[model samples]
Target: MRCLWLLGGSYLAAVDSARLDLSQVAKDPTPLCHEDIVDETCELLSAGRNVFQRGPSGKARVLSFGELQGALHTTLDSLASYMDFIDLDPHRAGPFMVNCMELCSLTVASLPLTHRPPAPDVACYTSDAGVVCDIDVSDASFSNISFDTANADGTNKFEHSTAVKVTVEMGNDTVWSPDVAPVDPEDRDDMPENVGLDQLRISVANLFRIFPPFELEVTESKNLDDVSDPQIVEENGTDAREVEVAIEVSPTHSPTDIVGSGDELELDLSDHEQDDAAVGAGTGEVASKRKRRASTDGEDSPTKRSSGSVTEAAVTAAELRSLLGEHLREIKMAWGDIQDRVTAVEKVTQGHKKELKVVHGKTKVLDQQMTAVKAKGDATARKAEDLETKLEGLTSKIEELGIKNQATGDGSDPWGEYLARRKEGQPGRSEGGEERKSLSEEDQRSLILGGWLADTKRSIIESEAQQILDMPALANFVDTNRVVVFGPRKSFGILRFKIRDGETAAGVKARMWEVVNHVRQNKQTLSSTTGLGDEGRPMWASFLKTPEARKKSAMCSMTRRVAMRLAAGVKTKEGAYYNEDATTVAGYDVDWSTGTVWSGTHKLASASHRKDISRNDDYQALKLGWVDIRAVVAVTGCDWSEAHEAFQHEQ
Candidate 1:
C-alpha cells in the first residue's frame, strides 16, 4: 500500500504509488529514488549541502522516502533508547520522535539532484529539544560562501568566493512551511507537466535564500500538537476502528552550532551518563557506550561504527577527513568558551576583593572610635579620683577649724546670743561706749576681701578685690556685702572680734531683709546663673531659721558651774565654805549689806583682794566670795529675799 505524507496542510503522494517492500527496503544499503518525486527530496538535500559540502565537484542524488524513513527511524530508535537511558519523560518521547522524523524529512527534501552520489558521514546526537543530525556535505557546489563582516542591517553578509564555516539554528516553539504559491485551477489544465515541477523547485529554493535557512510560519498557532492521538470517526452510526495519525515538525541547531566550552560539553556528557545509568538499571538494559573509530593508515575502520544494528555503506576517505574537520571546529569553539568563563570568574574575584577592603576600612574606623571612648572614660575616672581627694582634704580642714573655734570660745552660737541680746534690749556698744555704725559699701567689701584673703593665706590688694567685684557673676551682688560679712567667717580672729562688738545682730537682721528684697528683684538673674544651679544661693533667713539655730536661740544662757548645779537638783547650799592661804573653813556667813563673808569670826579674804586670780586656787576663792553670789543671783533673776534666806540657812 502507498504511504501518504502531509506537507503544508495538504496530503501528498510519496515518491511512488506502488507499495515498498519492508524486507527489501531494510536490506538495501542505497536509497531508492523515482523520477516523479525526485525534486521534492532533492530540494531538502540541497539546503544541507549549501552549509557543508565534501570533496571537489560535490553533488547529491535523489533518495526515496522509504530509505530516508528507515534511516531516520533507526536514528529515532537510538535517540529513544538514549532518552530512556537518561530517564526523560515518557510522554515527550512520542512528540520528540515525531519532530525528529519531520526535521530529517525537511532536510533531505532540499538538495539538488545528481547522477553520482557523494559519500557523506552522518551522525546523530541528543539535543535540548530532541535529536539532531550532522551530515558532512563539504563537497556540494555552493559550500564556498564566506562571512568576513556583518552588513549595515545587522546581518552577516556572505561572499561566495572564499571558503568559510557557518552554522544554522532553528528555535523551539517555531513552525515552518513551504513557500509554494497557490496554483490556479483553470491555468493548471493548460499548464505543461514540467511547469508545475519547475514552480515546486523554485518554491523549495526560496526557503533557503535567507541565512540560518528556516522561515517562521506566522499563520499557524504555536500550541499545535500534531503528534497527539487522533480522534476516531463513526460510519453509519456504528463505531469504526480508532485511527491515529500524528506528524510533528520542530527545528534545532547542529552540534557545532551549540556554543560551549569543553568543560560544559563534558558536564553535559556526564549528566547524560548518570541519567543513562539510572534508567538502564530500572529497565535492565546496559547503557550505550561511545565507540572511538580507530584510524588505520589515516582511514576509519569499517568495523568501528555505531552500536546500532542498521547496515550502512562503507565510509570513504573524503568522508573521514570531513568528520575530522568537524571535530577540529568543535575543539576551537570549546577553547573560546573556556577563555570566556575564566574572564568572568576573574571579574567576580575582583568584586569580592573590593568588598573585603571596604569591610576592613569600616572595622578600622570602629576600632579607632572604641579607642577614643576608652580614653574618655579613663580621663573621667581620674577627674573623679581628684574630686574625691579634694573632698577628703576639705573634710579634714573643716574638722581642724572646728577644733580651733571650740578652743578659742568662738564656737559658741552667735546667732543665739544675738537673739538673746535683742530680747534683753541690750544692743552692742563699742569700746568707746558709743553705738557702732554700719560700714559703707566700700569698707564692707574691703573687710570681706581682707577676711577672705587672710583665710585663704593670699595677699589682700585693692585691685584684686575690685577685680573680683567687677566679675560679671559678682557685679550685681556688689552692694550685698553685709550678707557675706554676717555669714560664717572662716577666720576665728575675725569671728571673735565680731562677737565681742556684738554688731552682727542688727546688721545681720537688716542685711537679711535687704537680701530678701534684692533676691525678689533679681530672682530671674539668680535662678538663671550657672554658678548657682537650680536652687540659687542660700539666704541668711533660711540658714538662721534651721532647727539647730532655733533650738539654740530658745535656750537660756547660764554659767557652766551654775548650770551643773541646777542640773544636779541641788536646792541647799551645803558646800558653802571659805578657804584662804591653805587654811579651810567649813562654815561661812555672808554679810549681805556689806557684801562680805565671815568664817568663824575670822574675816575671809575675797577673790578681788588678790592681784592675780589666774591660779586654780585663786579661781576657787573667787567663786566663794559674796560678790560671785550676788552676781549669780542677778544672772538667775531670783528674788533677793530668797537668796538671803538661802545664805542665812547655810550660815
Candidate 2:
C-alpha cells in the first residue's frame, strides 16, 4: 500500500509497480524537509516579533518561549497557505512533500517544540529520493569519504575507514527535550529510543523507497512459444525431415520410453533404419497375401502423418516451459543480490553520516576559535602600527636634533648614561646627573623650568580647587577653577589661572596665588593648607588695596543720617536695609512697654557695600593693569545681563 501525505492528510492509492513514475516529482524544487520548515518558521516568528516590538518609546520586548511557539505555529500555517498547490495530488505530489508531512507529524508529536528556545538548530540535506532532515543538526555530509574495497567477504564490505564510537542512553527525557536538563553523557545503552534519531531513520528509509538505487525492468517482452523458436535457421528450411525419419521407425519404439531418459542420449539413425526394415518385412507378407494392399497403403498414409505432427508439437511445448522456468529463477536470485547491496550501501552511508557529524562539530568549534583569533590579531596589528608610527616620529625628531649615535671619547654612547640612570630611577633625580646631559643649555633650562612650572601649577590648583569644593557656598560663584601652565619661551615659564564664571578675575587670581605662595614659602603641600578656609583669614587681601580715607568718606554722611533717624525713633522701610546710602545704619533696640525706640551707636548695613563693590572695583582695575597678571580670562556667564541692566538703569 502506498500512502501520500498531502493537504494536511494522508491518501492511499493502488499503483502498478511497472507504471509508477517519479520523473515529474523529482523535478520539484520545493523545500519540504521538516528541519527546513521548522527553521523557516522560527526565523519568520522572530522577524514578526521584532516588527511588533518596535515602538515610539524605543523599548524592545522579546517574545517568551510560549509566545514564540504560538508565533511559530502561526507562521507555519501562513506559509502552508501560500505554499498550497491546487493541482497537487497523491500521484502529482513529490516525494519530498509526502515524506516531509509524515516526518514532521511524527516529530511534532514527540517534540511539539513547546517552550523551545529561539534559534533551534535545524538543517537538511538532499538525496536522489527526497530531503533528509536532521532536526538536531548534529551532523553534516561526509567530509572525507573512503571505502574498504578489498573485503572479499561481504562482512564490513562498504564500511568507513575509521571506526565510530557511538554511546546511547535510555531514560533521559533531555535527549528529546533539549530545553530541559541535559542528558548524562556517561549513560550507556546499545539502542535508545531517541525520537529525533528515529525520525531521521524513517526519513532516510522513505527517501530511498521513493528513489530506489536500482531497478529491474523488462527490456523486451515475448510469448513463451516465440521464445521456444530456434535462433538459427535449419538446413533446407525443413523441420519435417527429422520428424519423417522418426515416424518411419518410432512406430515399433515407445515414445514414453525415450522421454524418460534425463542422460546424454543421442538419436541413433542406424537403429531407426533397422526398426524400419523389421516393420516393413512384417507388413510385406500381409501385402502379398492380399491383392487389395495397394488401396489400404494409400488410406493409412494420411493417418500416420497426422499422428507424427501431434508428437512433435508436444515435445516443443515441454522444452519451452522448462527453459522459461530456469530463466525466471535466475532473475529472482539476481534481484535478491541487488537488494543486499543496497542495504549494505545504506548502512555505510549512515556510518559516514555519524562521522561527518563529529567532523562538523569540530569545524564549528574551529571556526569560532578562528574568529576570536582574528579579532585579537587585528587589535594587536593596530597597536603595532600605532607604535611603529610613534617610533618613526620620535626617530625623525631625534635626527632633526642632530643627536649622534656614535660612542663618546669616554667609551659610552651619548644616550647610554641617561638610559642607565632611567633604569635605576628615583622619586626625584639630582640636578648634577646625566638627566640633561644630551640637551643643550636652553633645552635643559626649558625642561627644568617646565617641570617646575607644572609642579607649581598642580600644587596651587589643587589647593584652590580643594578650597572651592570644601566651601559649598562658593558653588554659587565658581563653576570650575584650575591652573594651566604653558611655555619655557626663551626666558620664563607661565602659569595661567583659569576660572569659570569668576566675575572678579583679579580678586580670584590674587586669592589663588596667595594660597600658592603660602604653600611654597612654608614648604608645605597643598593638603597642609587648613588655614585658607578660616573665617577671619582674608585670601583676597590684595584686591582691597585702597586709600583708607576714601573708603571711609564714601558713606560717612549717609551713616550719620541713618544714625540720626534711629536716634529719633523713626520707622525705616524693610528694603532700605540693602541700600548703599544706608537708610538706617544704626542698630537700635525697641522698648515696646515705654512705646519708644532706643538707638545704639553702630551701623545696621555697611554704608560702602564693600563686599559687593570691592571685587567689582578690582575687576575693573585689573583690565587696566592695576594687577600684573597674564593669559587670564574670566568667562562670565552673566556678564551681558549685568551690563545690560546697568545700561538700562542709566537710560
* Candidate with the greatest lDDT versus the true structure: 1
Q: List the pairs of residues colliding in candidate 2.
A: 585-604
For residues 1-651, write the lDDT of model 1, one tens digit per residue: 011211111121111112234355346533323322344333333323322222243433332222222222223444344334334443442323222223323434443332112222221222234332222222231122111133334333323223334332223222221112333434332111121222232222222220121222212212222212133212212111112222221222122111211111111111112212111101112212221212223422223334242322233333433443344333333333443465579779999999999999999999999999999998997676566546655664465456436645865665576678768877633214443344522233222222222242111222233443354654443342222222222221110112113434456445434434543444422211234335533211222223332222222111222322322332336653222211222234443323344434433334223323343331222233422334334333344455444444432
TM, every model: 0.25, 0.17
Ten contiguous residues with the weakest lDDT in model 2: 284-293
Q: How many clashing residue pairs appear in each of the predictions shown?
A: 21, 1
Residues 145-200 of candidate 2 have per-residue lDDT tens digits of 11112222333322432323322232331112111123354441212111223223
Question: How much RMSD separates candidate 2 from the native structure?
Answer: 34.5
Best by TM-score: 1
Per-candidate Cα lDDT values, in order, are 0.31, 0.29
Candidate 1 overall Cα lDDT vs. reference? 0.31
